[model samples]
Target: MWKLSVACAVLCSVSSVAHSQSNVLLYGIIDEGVQFNSNAGGNRQYYLASGELNGSRWGVRGSEDLGSGLKALFVLENGFDVNTGKLGQGGLEFGRRAYVGLSSGLGTVTLGRQYDSVVDFVGLLEAGDQWAGYLGAHPADNDNFNNTNRVNNAVKYTSRSLGGFTFGGMYSLGGIAGDTTRNQIWSFGAGYANGPLVLGAAYLNVRNPNVSFYGSGGTVAPTTGGVPGSNFGSSPVISGYASARTLQVIGAGAAYTFGASTFGALYSNTRFKGLGDASSGPVSARGISGSATLNNVEVNFKYQFTPALLVGAEYVYTKGSGPDGVGDVSYHQGALGIDYFLSKRTDIYAVAAFQKASGTDSSGKPAVASLSQITPSSTDRQTALRLAIRHKF
Candidate 1:
C-alpha cells in the first residue's frame, strides 16, 4: 500500500507539472534599402530607407498552458525606423501590436491595441514582398491593405479553423465621453485555405475617421481644405476627403498556387462618406462635400525558379470619384520584384515600380503620380527602384 501510494503521488505530481506550462519568445525583422525616386516634391531623389518590404520590428510573445485545453497568450510588438533609429508608428512603444488573450477549442478572445480583421484575413493576399515593398501599395493604400492603421481600445474575437474556414471580428470603442458611436470602429472578415488555394474577404468601418484613424497617430493641423498634415504624408489621394465623417472599406482577394508559381488578385472599395466635417486638414480648399469613393483592382504573379530565387510582378488600377465638381481621377501602376534568399531568415531583393495618373485630384488640381513614400510627382508619371536586404530573427 505504501509503495502504491508513493507511485500515485509521483504520477500526480508529474501530471500536474505537465498540465501547466509557459513559454516566452523574442523575435524581430529588419529590412533596409536604398531607393531612387523619379520625382519627389518634383525633384529626383535617392535615399536609404527602412522597412521597405517589411517594417522593422521586434516583439515578445508568451503563452501559458492552463489545465483545461486552454491557453493565455500575449504579444507586444514594437515598430521602428532603421534609418533614423526612431520609433515607428508615430512613436508608440508597441505600435505594431500589443494584445493579450485566451485561446481554447472554440477560438480566441483578445483585448488591447490590435490589427483589424482585414489585415488578418485579406492583407496577405493583396501583396507580399513577392513584393510591393511599401512603395507598391495600391494608390494611397486607400483600402488599408498596407495596414496603415491599427485599432485601439479594441476587443477582438477569432474563431478556430473549421474545415478549411476561419473567421474573426473586432470592435473598438471610441472612448468619447457622451457619444457611443462617434469615433467607433468595427471590422470583420473570413478566410479559407485548402491545398494550394487561399481566399479572403473583409470589411472595416470607422466613424469620424479623420480623427480616429488618421489622427490616431497624434496631433494634426485642422482642415485648411487640402489634405491634413499627418503622418500618412501629404497626398492628393486623401486630400479632399480629409474631412470625411466616416470611412468604410471592403476588400476581397484570392490566390492559387500551382507547381512553382502562384497567381493572385484583389479588389477593394474605399469610401469617405459625409465629407467636409472640418477635422484633419485643408477642407474648404479641396472643395470636397458629400462623399468621395475609390475602387482598386490588382493582379499579381509570383514564380520560384529555385529554392533560393523568386520573382514577382503586379499591376493595379485605381479610380476615384467625389462630389461637387471635383474631376474624376484614375491611376495605373505596375511593379516587378526579385528576391534571393540567402537563408531562411535573411535575403536580398530589388523592386521597381511605375505609376501614371490622370484627371483632377481631391485638391481640385490635376492628379499627379504618387508612390507610397515618394512625393507627389510634378507630372502625371513616376517611377521608383529599390534594392534591399532583410533579416529576421
Candidate 2:
C-alpha cells in the first residue's frame, strides 16, 4: 500500500509540472487612421490606412518549458490592411512573421521566414522604429537595417547578450531547383547597448534581385543596357542578366536622456557593387552612379510631457549620386508625432510627415521622376497625417 501511494504521488506531481510549463497567449493590435497627402499630385486625397503608429497585427505566441533552462517557442503573426481588410506581406497569410525555434541560456535559433540580422539590429536604432514604418522608411527600404523587412526561406541564429552586447546572423536559401545560386540572400550584424549608449552595424548581399518588380505589373525585364559607357545605343534594349548585387552598410547612432527628454543622431552609408558584367561584355553598365554616394543622416528628439503623454520629432536627409554626366538627387523629410498612453498596453497617437525629393533615381537619372511616386512621372513631394488607437493583448 505504501509503495502504491508513493508511485501515485510521483505521477501526479509530474502532470502538474507539465501543465505549469505550457502556455499559449493570444495578442493583437488594430490601428487605423485617415491620411491626407498634400501633394498626392493628380488628386490630394484622404484615405483610411493601417499601421499608423505601428504595424497592425494579430498573432499567437507560445512557449513550453522543457526544464533545465530550455524552452520551445513559436510565433505566427499576420499583418493586414485595416481599411481594406486585406492581408499584407505579398498576400501570404502570415506575412509579418512565422517561425518556430528553441531557446536556452546560450541563445535562440529560429527557422522559416524571419527578419534578417541587419534589420533586426539596426532597425531598432532608428527613431520610432524606422519612423512608424513604410511611410517613413528610407527610400526603397534599400538597406534592410532601416525597415526590418522579412526574409523567406531563412535560418537565423541570435546569441545571448553578454555584458550588454549581442550578435546575430541569417542565411536565406534560394530554394530554386537547378539554379541554387539564384535569388539567394544573406546577412550578419551585431549590436551593443549599455546605459544610454547604443551602436550597431551590418552587411547584406543578394543575388539577382528582381528589380522589375519595382514598378508596374512586373513584366519589365531587368536590364543591363544601363551600364555606363556601354556601346548599346541610348535606351538600349537589353534584357536583365543574371548578376550579383551587393550592399554593404555601416551605421552608428547615439542617444542621451536628460530629465524627460531624449535626443539622438544616426548616420549610414550603402554601396552597390557587382553591377558590371563579369564576362567583360560591355562592362555590363556598372558604376553609373558616378562620383556621388548614398548617404543618410538623421536627428531626432523625444519628450515625455507626462507619464502618459509623449511627443517626438525627427528630420532625415538622403542623397544619391551617379557618375560624371549622370545626375544626383537628394531627399529631405521631416516627421512629428505624439502618443498618449491609455494604459501600459494601449495607446492613441497622431503622426504627420512631409517629404521633398530633388535628384535622380537610383540609376542616377534626372529628377524628372519623383521618388515618392514609386512610378515614373510622379511629383517629388508628399505629405501624410495619421491618427490611430492601438492595444496589445
Using TM-score, give the best candidate's number: 1
Clashing pairs in 1: 223-281, 224-281, 224-282, 224-283, 225-282, 225-283, 225-284, 226-282
> Tens digit of lDDT per residue, candidate 1, span 210-278?
777776753444544454543345787775676677889999999999999999999999998887776
- TM-score for each candidate, following the candidate numbering: 0.92, 0.80
Angstrom error of the Cα, residue 12, model 1: value is 16
Q: Any runs in candidate 1 off by more than 4 Å, and if so which?
A: 1-20, 128-130, 218-232, 279-282
Each candidate: RMSD to true structure? 4.0, 6.2
The lDDT values for all models are: 0.85, 0.64
Give a tens-digit lDDT track for model 2, residues 136-178: 5555444544443467778888999999899988887877799
Please identify model 2 stretches exceeding 4 Å from their true place: 1-15, 128-131, 146-148, 177-180, 211-244, 276-293, 323-327, 363-365, 368-377
